[model samples]
Target: MENIFNFNDESSINNVEIHGEYSLIIVILSIIIAVVASYTALSLNKRASENSFFHKNFWLFLASLCLGFGIWSMHFVGMSAFSLPVSMSYNNIMTVLSIIPAMLASFIAFYLANLPRRNLWTYFFAGIAMGTGISSMHYLGMYGMEMDVVYTYNPILFLASICIAIVVSVIAVYIFSTVQKYETNYKVQLIISLIIGLAISSMHYTGMAAMNFYIPKGYEMNLSHFHSTEMYGLAIIVTLGMTILLGILLLSSFIDRFIEYRANYYDPFTQLPNRRLFEKKLHSPKVLAVWHIHDLEHINREFNYAFGDEVIRRLVYIFKTLTPSKVEIYRIEGHRIALIARDGDSAKQLKGSLKEIATVLRKPIIVKGHEVYLYGVCAVSDANQYENTPNIYTNVLAVLNYPSITYNHDIVYYDSSIHTYTFEREIADDVNRAMNDDELFLVYQPKVCLNPNETVGLEALLRWNHPKYGFLSPAVFVPILEEYDRMVKVTDWIIGRVCQQIADWKLENISFKQVAINIPGEYVTSPLLLKLLTQKLNEYGLESSQIELEITENSFVKNMEEAMRAVGEFRKEGFSVALDDFGTGVSSLSYLKQMPISTLKIDKSFIDDVPISPKDSAIVQAIVTLGESLNLNVVIEGVETKEQVNFLKGASRKPIFQGYYFAKPMQPHELIQWYRETRVED
Candidate 1:
C-alpha cells in the first residue's frame, strides 16, 4: 500500500505536499443526499406556512431536522470519500454538535421564506445567515476529524467557499419562495433542489481544497484504534438513515397536497368538479351550458332543505346518467349545474345533452317516500363566440336569467340578442332608484264610444324615462321588473299615482268616466294588488268604479281558477274588470265564459291588419258579436284607419275604440288639454 503522505521521513515532511484521492461512489452518494434533503426541506417548509399553528410547528421542526441532518450527512460522506495516508476518525460528540448550526440555519431560512412579504434585502440577509451556519458546520465537522497530523487552510479558498454557499443559498431560497405558490409544479422544485445540492457539493469540495495537512517534523503519527473503515461505515449509515427519513416526509407532503387539491376542486356531496375548477377550465375554447334548477327553491320551501339537497343530488345523478360522455358536469351553484363539452363536442351536441337531462328531470325523483319533480332551463354559450372567458360566462348568465325563459322552459343559446337581456338586467338593478328619482311616470290613451265618438275613458299606461336609456317602453322595463319580482313595488306606485291623478281631476272639475290601469297577470292573483288598490282608493277618497282593472288574457293561463276568483272579488268590490289582449291566448274562449268581466278589449295585433285583411275583419266582427252576446262592453284596439272603424260599425252592436287614430298616449297635462280641446271640437 502506498501512502500519499509519510511522516516516517520527518526531515522531509516540510517539503512533502499532501494530496488525497476520492471514491466516486461515496461522492455521488453525498450529492444525492444533498438534493433529497433540500427538496424535502423546501416541501415541508411550504406546508408549514399553509397549516394551522400546531401542524405548522410540526412541519417546521421536521424540515429543520431533515435539512440539518441532511447537510451533516453529506459533509461526512464527502470526507469519507477522501483517502488519507493515515487512519482517521471523527469525534462523535463534536460531529453530533456540528449539526445544531445546520438545523438553526434551516429554521431561519424557512422562517424568512414563509414571511407574508419579503424584499430583496430579506433574501440577502437570510442567505447570509444560512450561509454562515452552513460554513460553520463544515469547519466544525472538519475540526472533529481525529488524526495525528495538523491541518491549516488556504484563507482565500476558505472565504471563497463561504461566499459560494451564501450566493447559492440566496438563489435557492428565492426560487423556492417564488414557486411555492404553485404547489403542483414539482419540476421547478426538482430543478431548484439540484441547484442547492450542487451548491452544497461545491462548497464542501472547495473547503476541502483549502485544507493543508502535514506531519510535524520529528513527530510520530498515531494509528492505534483509528479505523478508516469505521468512519466510512458511519457515513454510509447516516446517509442512508437521513435519505429514508426525507423520503417519508416527501411522501407525506405529497399525500397532504393531493387531499387538499381534492377538497378545493371537488363538490363533496355530488362528487363532481366544483365551480372553482369549472372557472379554471373556462379559459379554454369549448361550449358551455349552465342548467339551473329553477324550481329547487320551491322544493326547499315546500319540504325541508335536506329534501331540497336530496333532490339536487338526484337531479345531478339524472344529468350524469343521461348526458353524453363528452359533457362534463360541474356543480357551479347551489341550484345550478354547469355542463361543458369537450374538444370534439359542438354546441348542438351540448344542447342535445341538455334536452336529454331535462327530459329525465321531468320524471319524478322519489326521495323519502315523496315524489319530487324538477323543472330547469339550460343556457348555452360558446367560447369561440366571445372574446374571453368572462364575456362567455356573462353572456351565458344573461341568457339563462332572461325573464321569458322562466315561463318558456326552452333551452336558450347565447347570441347578440342576449346583450339586450344584459342591458335589461342592468336596468333591473336600477329600477328602485328610477322610482325614487322620479324617472317613472304615466301617460293616458283615451277610449271613445264609436257612434257618438265621445271620450268615455282612458287607459293609464306606465312609462320609464330612464336618464340613461331615455323613455324605456313598458314592453322593455316592464318585463324586467316582472322578472326580478320588482313589479310589486312599481304596481304599488302606479296605483298611488293614478288615484292621486284622479283626485286632481276631480278638484279641477273635469268630468271623466273611469281610468283603466293595466295589471300584470302575476299580480292579478296576488292579494297585495287588491289590498293596495283598496288602500289607494280610500287614501285618495276615490270610488272603485272610477278605476277600471284591465288584465291581459295570459293572466288566466297560470291559475285560471284563482284568477277568476280574484276577478270576481274585484267585481264585487265595485271595480270594473276588463279582459285585455283578447284573442291572443289559447284559453280565451273557455276563460271568457267563466271569468267575471265588464269589458272585452281586442289585442292590437288582430286590429293592425283589420279592414285590409278580410280574415282579420271577420275575426274582429266575430269578437264584437261575441262580446255583445255575452253582454260585455267591447273595445276595438289599434283602430288606425277609417276603413277599420267602418267595418267595426257593421257589427250588430257599437263597440268602444282606442288607438292612435283617436290620439296617441299623452302626458297627464296634455290629456287635460286634449280633453278640453276635443270637447270644443265636438
Candidate 2:
C-alpha cells in the first residue's frame, strides 16, 4: 500500500541532473518556503508560553520541517535533470520532496495539541489547515514527475530519513523543554535550541532522502559520486540552506529572548519568583499566595547567598508542594517574607486556620547537603478587599508586618486594621541620622591564644548608638545599609577605625597581633577594595599585616569571584584574610585554594558547645586538618569554658584561639588602657 509512489530503480542514465528553467523556480520557491517555515517555527517557540497547545519547542520542529522541505525541493530539482527532455512533471516530483517536512510539522503540531491547554482546539484546526495545505500542495505538485521513487532498504537511504524525522521531532521537544526550564531571556538557550532543531531536521530529511540512493550492488564507495561536482554542489547547497536558515532562526530566537527578557519582569539571581510574577498572581483573591522570609540578612550572613539561595529554593519547593495545584509564588527583593495565600471556600477549614496553616508552611530549609533550621514569618492577606489598587504592595507589607509578628518569629495571620509602619518609620529616621552622624563606633571582642591564655587579637564589631533609639546591633542597621547602598560607607568606617585602633595599640607597644574587621558580602567585591584598605592602613601608619579581614562564610560563598579577588588583594598587600564562621556553610575545597586566605575562624555556634559536643570536636578536627593541608592558620572563637580551652590546647598544635575567656570586647579607650596595662604590668 505504501509502495504506490515507490521505485527501487538504480539505473544509471547518461543525462545531466537539474539543468532546466522550471527546476530553478522549484528550488527558489522551496528555499523561500523553508525560510518562512523556519522563522515561523522559531517565533512560535519563543511565544510558547503565550500559546497553550504548542509545546515550547513545536516551533523548533516547524523550523526543521521548513528546512527539510526546502532541502527536499533543492535535492529533487537537482535529481530530476536531463541532457534533452524537460521535466513536465516537475510539480509532481516536487510534491514527493515536500511531503516529509510537512508530515513532521503535522506530527509536532499534533503533539502540542494533545498537551493540556485552554485553546488547544484552535491549534488543532490550524494544524489541520497547515498540514492539509502542505500535503495537498505536494501531492498535486508531484504529478509531473514521470519517475516515482519510494524509500527502500537496499539504498539504506529511506530508513535514515525516517530515523532522522523521529529524532528531530523528539529532540525539538527535548530542547524546547530544556531551554524553557529557567524561563529567562539568556541568549545561550535560544541559540542552542535553534541549532538543535536544525541539526535534528537536517539529519531526518537527509536520512529519509539517503534511502533512495542505492549502491549499484558493489560500487558502494562511489568514488565517482564523490568526484562529481553536481552531487557535491547539491550537498553543499542543501547543507548551506539548512545551516543558514537554522543559524538565522537560532540568532532570532536569542534576540527574541533578549528582548522579552528585558521587556518582562525578572530577577537575574536565584531565578525564583520575582515581583512581577507575584503581580501575575494577584488576580483572584482565592487563587493567590505570598511568603515573606523573616531573616533574610541572617540567611545572607550565616551561610552567604549561595546557601541563602538554597534555603529559598527549599522553601519554594515546600510551599509549592503544599499549596493547591493552581497556586503561584513570588520572591520580592530577597527580603521581608510575603506570600499570598488562596482564600477559598473549597477548603473551608484550611482557610480559617491561617496561623496554623502558616506554621506548617514555615519549616526548616536544607542547604549544602545539611538541613538549616529556620522559622519563617509571612504576610498573607485577603485580595478580596480591593481598596486602593495602586498601593497593594504597601498593604501586603503592612499585613506582613502585623504587630503580632514583631514578637513572633514564626508565621503570623493577616489583619487588616493593624498597620506595622512604626519600625519602618524608626529605621527611616535612623538611616537619615546615620548619613550625618559620625557616631557609628567599634567594640573590640577579645581573641586569645589557647595554651598561654594570652590575648592575641580583637574582632572589631560595629555598634550604633542612635541619640533617638538607644543602642543598635549591626543586625538591625547593617540591613538598612545593605538595602540603601550605605553598607560600603559603613564598611569603610569600620576598616578605617579598626586600622586606627591597631596603630594606637602599636604606639603603646601592645604587640596585639591583629584587629579583624567584619566585611559585608555585597560590598567585598569592589575592584577598589585593595586601594581603600591600603589608603586606610597607610593613613594610620599601620602595616598591612597588622589588620585582618573577617568574612562570614555567607559573604565569602556568595560572590566567589569578587570574594577571592578581594582576599587576593588583601593578601597581596600583606594583610591577612580569614574565613569567618567556618563549619556553618558549604566550604568548597576549591575555594580554599583560590582565596587569599591566612586563617579560618571557627564560628561561635561551634565554639559555644565545644568539648561537650562531639560534633563540634569532629568539625574542629576536620577544619584543623583542612588548615594544615592548605597551610593556613585556624582560630576558634567564643572559647569561654576551660574545658573548651583545654580541649583546644591539646588538639590544636599550632592553633590560635579567640573568646570571652581572655576578655570581653572593649571600647577604643579601653583597648588602649588594656594594651598599656599588659605592657606595664608584665
Candidate 3:
C-alpha cells in the first residue's frame, strides 16, 4: 500500500523491472486463429491459379479478412496482458479505428502473394507494406490507452521489432505462395503457421519491452474506468466468432473440392460414372460389358440426332431400372455405355441382365410422338480374365467388329476365335493399296434370254487379287471393303472403268445391251455417287441406258426416300435401275411397288430349288407375275442348271437367266470371244 509496486522502491525491487501477465486462453486462441487463417489463405491462394480476375479477387478478399481479423485479435489480446500499478482503460474510438490498417495491410499482403505471377520485388514491397500496417495498428491501439500515464520507447528495440515484422511477414508470404506448387503437406503448413505466430508475438513483446511508463502528476482518480471482466468477455467473443467463421470457410472449401471431383468423374448428361472413373475401377474384379448402339448412326442419319439422343436416354433409364443399385454404369462415349457388376455378381448373371435390358430396349418407344425401335449388340467381357482396362475394353470391342455378329440378337459374348479385327485391319490395308495400285479388276457375267437362248446383257462384278492372298474372291474382299468404308472408292473406280470398257467395246464394234453395277446401301444416299455416275457417262460419251445402276432390296428398305430419289433420277436421265436380291430383304412386295425399278431380279434361294421345290417354284412364279403386271422385266438369278433354265422357260412369259448354266462370270477378253463364238453358232 505504501508505493511498494513502484519500480524505484529500493527495499521491494532489486532492479528496474516491469511485469506482464498474459491470459493463457487469449494466447492459445490467438495461435489457433493464426493457424486457421494461414490454412484459409493457402487454400484460397492455391485456387487462384488460372482463375478469373473477379474470382481471384473474391478469394483474396476473404483471405485478407481472415488474416486481418487474426492479426487484430492477436494484437488486442496481447495488449490486454500489460499490467500496471494504476487503473487503465482504452479509448473505444481508437480501439475500433486500429482495425482499418490491420485489414488493409492484410489485403495488400494476400493480393501480392496470390498474384498470378509474382516476383521478388512484389514480395518485398508487400512485406514492407504489411509490416508498416501492423506497426501502425499496434501503435494506434497503444494510443487507445486512456490511463493518466506517459510512455516512451527504446529506439533500437522499436526498430528491431519493425524489422522483425517486415522480414518474417515476407518469409511467411513466400512460404504460403510456394507451398501449393511444392505440395508442402498440411504438417508443413501448421509448422509455418506456428513460426508466423511466434514472429508476430515476438514483434508485439519486443515493442512492449521497448516502452517505459511514467505516471503523470495530479492524475489520480477514485474509480478506474477499465474492467477485466469486460475485456475477458470481449476476448472470448472475438475468438469464438472467428473460430466459427473459419470452421465454416474450411467446410465450404472441402465441399467445393468434393463437388469438383464428382463433376470430373461422372457424366454430365446421365449422371452415371464416366470413362475416367470406369478406367479406375478396372483393377477391381467385376464383370464388365459394353452396350453398343449399332444403329444409332443410321437412326441419326435417317432422323435428327435429337431422336437418337432420346433413344440413348430412354435406354439408360431402362438399364438403370433393370440393374441393381450396386452395379456401376458409365457412358464411355456416344452410343456406348459400359456396365460393371459388383464382386458378388458373376459374368453370366451380368449377361442375363443385359439380355433383359435388350429385350426391353427392342420395344418401340414414342419419341416426338413417333414410334422408334432401337437396335444394338451387347458384348460382355470377363474382368476376371482381363486385369487391365484397355485390354478389357479392346477385347469387348473386338467382338463387335465381326460382320457375322450382327445386332439382330440380344447379346453376344466375347468370342476370341473371331480374329476378324486383325484380319480385317490387314484386309483394309490391302484394299487401300488395291485402290491406288490397280490390283482390283472387273468381270462380266452374261445374262441370257431364256426363251430365245441368246445372251442379252452382262452384270459387272468386282474382283480383288491380293499380292499375298492371290485372287481374293468378291465374297471375301468386298465385305472387307464395306467394313472399312473403302467401298465408295471402289465403286467410283468400277464405274469409270466399266464406262471406259463400254466405250472401248463400242470402238471394237462389239455390241452389248447393258453392263450392270452393284451399289452398296451406304452409298445409295450419297450425292457423290450420282455426281460420279453423271460425270463418267458424260466423260465416256456413253448412253445411260448402256450402264444400269443395280441396288439391293436392303438399300431401298433402309432408306426408301433417298433410294427412291436416286432411282428416280436415274430413270429421269434415261438410265435403267434394278432392284437386285429381291426376296431376301424385308417386305419385298411392299417396296417393289414403291421403287422406280425397271428390272426385278428373283433371289437365288427361290431360283436354286426351282422345278423341284413347289414353294420355290410358286415364289418365283408369283414374283415373275408381279413383275409382269408392273411392267418390270424379270431376271432370274443363279440359274446353275439346265433344269432351272427349263423351269423358268416353262413360265407363260420366260424370265431372263444369269448363272453357270449360261456361262460363269468371264473376263473382258473372254466375254468378247464368247460373244463372237455364240454369234457364229447362231
RMSD over all Cα atoms, model 1: 27.6
Order candidates by TM-score, high to low.
Answer: 3, 1, 2
Tell me the deviation in Å of residue 229 in model 1: 8.7
Per-candidate TM equals 0.42, 0.39, 0.51
User: In candidate 3, what are the lDDT values of residues 38-154, reduced to their tens digit?
Assistant: 566555544454212235666666666666666667776676654465566788999889878877987898777756567888888888877777777878888887865556788
Per-residue error (Å), model 3, residue 599: 71
Q: Tell me how far the alpha carbon of residue 559 in candidate 3 is from the true structure, in angstroms, after superposition.
A: 58
lDDT of 1 by residue, 1-682 (tens): 2355544354363644456677788789889888888888776765564422236767777787788877888898888778766667789999999999988988888777766667888888777767877788999999888976667788999999999999998998887777564332467779988987877888999999998777655445444322243565855666576756667685666676566556767998888899767865665647878887765688889988988888877777787887777777899877778888756555557767777766666677798899877677777777776676556665666676565567234678787664555666787888888878888888999998745547889998888887754455465567668888888788788888889999999999996789998888888999988999999888889999999999988888888999999999999999999999989887857558788999999998888777889898888889888889899999888876545655676663666888765677899889989888667434
| lDDT of the candidates, in the order given | 0.77, 0.55, 0.72
Worst 10 residues of 2 by lDDT: 13-22
Candidate 1's error at 607, in angstroms?
58
Q: Report how far residue 175 has shifted in candidate 3, in Å.
A: 6.5
Which of the predicted structures, 2 or 3, would earn the higher TM-score when compared with the native?
3
Q: List the candidates ranked by lDDT, beginning with the highest.
A: 1, 3, 2
Which runs in model 3 stand beyond 4 Å of their true positions? 1-21, 28-32, 39-62, 79-100, 111-120, 136-163, 171-191, 206-249, 252-256, 295-312, 344-349, 366-371, 383-390, 419-682
